[model samples]
Target: MRGILAGWDSLDPALRWLMRINLIALTTATLLLASAYLLGFRHTSVEIDLGVMAVSIVLMLVTPPLCRRYGAPAAIVGLTLSALIFAVGGTWATPNLSPLTALLTMVPLLVGFAYLGRRWIQVLSVVAVAGSAGVAALAEWRRTEAVSEEWWINAVVIAASLPAGVAVVVLLVRSAYARLQGQSDELVESRRRVVEVADAARRSLERDLHDGAQQRLLASSVTIERARKELRAGRHDSAAALLDQLAADNREIVTELRELARGIYPPLLTERGLVAALQSTARRSAVPVTLDVADVERTDPQVEAAAYFCILEALTNAAKHSGAAEVHVTLRGRPHLSFTVCDDGRGFDRGAVDAGGLLGMEARVAAAGGRLTLDTGPGRGTVVRGEFAP
Candidate 1:
């Protein structure tokens, strides 16, 4: 059963809906036909109705395989043509079933045009439904069948056009509801990821302060107390040497704090612009870098910051992971702020990318209303690019 319906989930909602309708109708017809002898229905011939049912089941069953092998366009064309044949053929096969088939056939007609958007196919599908309804109405005008057997056929055939329109409305509501649901789910997940990344960064900053600047400040306080004790005992040389060491320690602490702060957000980014900040980053990279940044005017601070950080992360990744000798960095100003970092490194498999590095960059870019993409493969080098909105 799973194999039979393997590709069904990939079909468009409208296509799936048409398939469900056909399945239900086929099941109902099967049951009705089973008891037709008792009801004295299908007494004219079982063979014709049986053949029609068999052909329809076969056509419907083949749709999923075609969807997998040829994709939606081919599958849609085949399914729509089958529906057209079913519509016109049912009217000729049995005037009784024509109204139901004509009404249902409009399902594909409306859905097909909305999805496929081909004018010629639209005209052909429209003609099929209208033509089937016309054929049924003409048969009603000069009918020789028993009046009891044909009580409601013509009324339904006349009303087929209205029901077709209603089906379009029904599908429109369903499509809209589904779209909203999908977007809502994505929004929730995106927010959750942003919060998670922010929490992780906060923890990292706390750890850095505790290990680097905070630890150095505590040690310096101890040294200052020792120097005071030496001065109180009138040991001038000892106190002076201790004071010099304390000054050195203080300088180291200041440098450590500034470096840590730079990791969070660069001071140069605000002072000069994105181009100057990026050049500083390129100079600091472990691998050789060829920087080519456009001297374009700055836009949104947030947009510039996102592009800056993504390039920084990409350069870090290339240095740490890809053993590349040289990296090329590019920034564009026109249309919108964008940047690319390409390295002639021995790239790793994309499937094995570090989620923390790449995902964090992606989230940061998304937060700033931009996009990030990576192009890489083993032994093929790596390229990371980001583009911001105009």
Candidate 2:
């Protein structure tokens, strides 16, 4: 069943066309059977019945595709009418068990109607019931022989079984379709959130590069130029002091650039793996951070990177905003990797923080198919937790 569904999903436009062709062929073949029965074998009114059956089959096959493409309700009406025509035509000629075949034809129609949704399903049901009743009455009127007790019981059995079978199939198909739609909706929502986070992260990086690193580099360049001019003017003491200050400023700028680059993408995550990198991050945090990592070897690189960044961002946020004295970082690397960063701070409202660093952290996590959650409120220290599957 899984393979069949997968194959159906893999089909291109041409294959869909082939499916429509096959539906037409099946309808034509059913009509041919009815014609052969009435004309070739039973020797009933041949030309009119054949023409009617052909028209009904053509309507059945042609109308569905049109309705499927254009007007769905009209297509459903076409299918229902096609079934009724077959039922009434069979009843008029055979009058023995023709209504049974007509009811049986409604099974696929019901399934299609259910798949389409409630409005169509209701329309199809009303048509099927009314059509079947009309066919049964026509069959009763057209009977040449007297109706027997056994025939009534058989008719009742056929009538009951056909609709029941159709109902079951329709309900089952409807349930399965609903489940698929729900899963599709969930996937769409997840992707939308991921896109939002990534866009915010890009904007934040642009701001950081423009406002922080760019300005620092500019200041360092100005200091070096001033030092050079002082040295050329034969002011050795002032030049030496200026040069020393320039060197110090350049070093600070370099450090800030490195830190900014790391924030963009950490090299430690790729080199040393998640555990060592997270440990280093925890150790470097401003507040006292307790680090705990278990079964580090099992962690995948992408998972490791996401976990590391989430911790770094959370710790950075804690230091900058939380006014926290202490923080804790923990990692569990079994079943699925999980990380938590908790700080003891004068916590602000999580809702009030605009999506900047936190949003970047979320993007990184989501890119690896993970989730980041922040828990903080007034007087409540923040706890940022993230989880990723392998």
Candidate 1 C-alpha lDDT tens digits along 1-390: 567766655455545665555555554554555455345443333435445555666676777776654445555555555565555545554565555556556555555553454674667576666766675774465255523355443333223323443454465457757756975886786798788888878998899999988899999999999999999999999999999999999999988888787889999999888888988888888999998866468778898788888888888888998999999998877535678899999988867755766777888898886668888889989999887644
- Looking at candidate 2, the ten consecutive residues that score lowest on lDDT are 4-13
Tens digits of per-residue lDDT for model 2, 132-248: 677677777766552333454334323433343344334545655775696577577657767777787788889988898788778878878887898889888998998888778
On TM-score, the leading prediction is 1
Score candidate 1 by lDDT.
0.69
- What total of clashing residue pairs does each candidate reach? 0, 0
TM-score of predicted model 2? 0.51
Per-candidate TM equals 0.52, 0.51
Scored against the true structure, residue 32 in model 1 reaches a CA lDDT of: 54
